[model samples]
Target: MSRPLIYKGRGSLGNAAGRFEKHTRRAEDDGWGSLDAELPPLQTEIIVDSSQSVISYNDSPDIPFDRSINPYRGCEHGCIYCFARPSHAYLGYSAGLDFESKILIKPEAARLLREEISKRAYRCAPLALGTNTDPYQPLERRQRIMRGILEILAQTRHPVSIITKSALIERDLDILAPMAEQGLAAVYLSVTTLDRTLARKLEPRAAAPQRRLETLDRLRAAGVPTGVMVAPLIPVLTDPELEAIVSAAHAAGAQSAAYILLRLPLEVADLFEEWLRQHYPLKAEHVMRRVRDNRGGKAYDAAFHQRQSGSGVYADLLAQRFRLVCRGLGLTGDLPALRTDLFRKPHAGGQMSFDFFD
Candidate 1:
């Protein structure tokens, strides 16, 4: 049998078609030499998103915030276990390689946000960034969409929260630090694993674990409220580092911490399983067995409360451990609440409303 092809820096090994596609295509090796011919590395393709609006709102009980801004549609970090992967299918793209290699950017995000929030019926609340994808992903360096959005948020004195796995956020400390000083900003760095090798495989293009910790420290020093998320705590793969991750974040100046059980919604299940079979063949079966144990003998359970942290002996133990470690490290509280009272809706002419001094 032909061995599976591996792309050096990419996370997904295959590019299966999106579920909504009416037809599917498969690669087949024929007698000709073309099938196995060496091909050039795939390049990232940037597509402009022509969305008229910038803010997305959701009422899911599991989510802490109602409104969020995703400057980009597909994430370049290419984490195989990302629950957001399935969302790519809606754009007629695969949940695997295509999701990482094909990016959609909203160049007008800041303008749209300003228009939306300046409306008479608009309400002020803490808007979230990097919820569906990393706002600081590599393209942000060239696109600068996120920076423009932050500039508007800062100008309006609007409350904003962010989560990212990239060190690129440091570049915006000038904007974030001042907003944070006014209780209008909070940031969370998502640390998957401290193992360099695993991180390279899991999120090939994201920042290194140690670099994220250092970034957290810098944010804290700048007076930016910092939090750490030991996300997607895989059972056999990353469970052992639970306490270590919390302790390390505390030492790195994180004021709060949280975690999520591995989620395998839709195509993410197959992609993640394939990744395990390729990277951890020996422990693949055991890892999945434990995952199913946490999911009540299934690959996943989509129930809101049960989804973040499954319901089982192992899940219970993991939660108890997290609580204990957080308590010991004084990480038991949430990040300080963001301020919405200071929000100022700029007029159509780009000046603030005149009722301030009255």
Candidate 2:
């Protein structure tokens, strides 16, 4: 008997037809299995990449950071609304299961980061981690690639910022605390919804909402600067809890908070649609209709300014609600910028020296 195919919304897992091929037309016309399927089994694949580059720079006008490093590709968090899912298609992989199951690790990330930072022309800035994909995903527990990157940054006194939804980050408090004390580091924990059942289905592999809150409290008590991020505020599904999420974070010791409207870009649009129809068929149409209204009748709008916050009456209302609630809860504040003057490149002998002494 043939093994049952794993239906991952877009197509069957591991099937050549699911892989992106050049010069292939009418691909969508191919018949696939039904959309309804039980939980897909987790499959892991190891890939060794030999590349000289690791840090990525972005020039988006609205973004705060210019440089970031993603130690891993295709996050295992398996968030249905992930905007980075389309990246897997570039590797001839499906944006559905392949985006979550197939893992890529950058073992040499620390070496390259050190080489880059040691350059005479290197400038000290707040290097953001887990921007494109999570650096502390499940694989990090075993691979320890994110830990390696943190070690290098700590040695050089390089300023860094981290954003994650995993309690696993608490394990690095030993390194983060000192940096934070020196005003060299800060962290933002993303918490989407407080409802456990909804969180499980929306972000299948992320830490439970309560666990993330506990992590935030621990970070604050450790003298590490921390903030809360209520991201991807889904309409009708998780939107109702926006104010409550911010209030809870504030009470948990988060000094500040921010939020972003849900973005359905590229393959994420299809994946989210499939998830909505399957899980909340009653509200699927209403959700998509609101989403389209926010995007000006399109599935997504990539405009820089309007991308983070949607455009339209509903989007405006959500924005207003978030602003009002954040102000009321005293959670609307920006973290102090980390000091860069303290940065000193370590010498080859594992010591740091300053030229001012001479």
TM-score of each: 0.96, 0.89
Q: Each model's C-alpha lDDT?
A: 0.92, 0.82
Model 1 earns a TM-score of: 0.96
Model 1, residue 23: displacement in angstroms? 1.6
> How do the residues 1-358 of candidate 2 rate in per-residue lDDT, one tens digit apiece?
1222344322223222233665432223223533334646556676876778888888999899999999988878888888888888877776677777787889999888887877788888899997778888888999989998888888778899999999999999998998898898999999999999888878878899999999999999999899998988888888999989998888888998888888998778877887787778999999999899999998899999899899999999999998899888876679989888977776645444554122
Enumerate residue pairs that collide in model 1: none
Candidate 1, after superposition: displacement of residue 351 in Å? Answer: 4.1
- The model with the greatest lDDT is 1
- Top candidate (TM-score): 1
Model 2: worst 10 consecutive residues (lDDT sum): 9-18
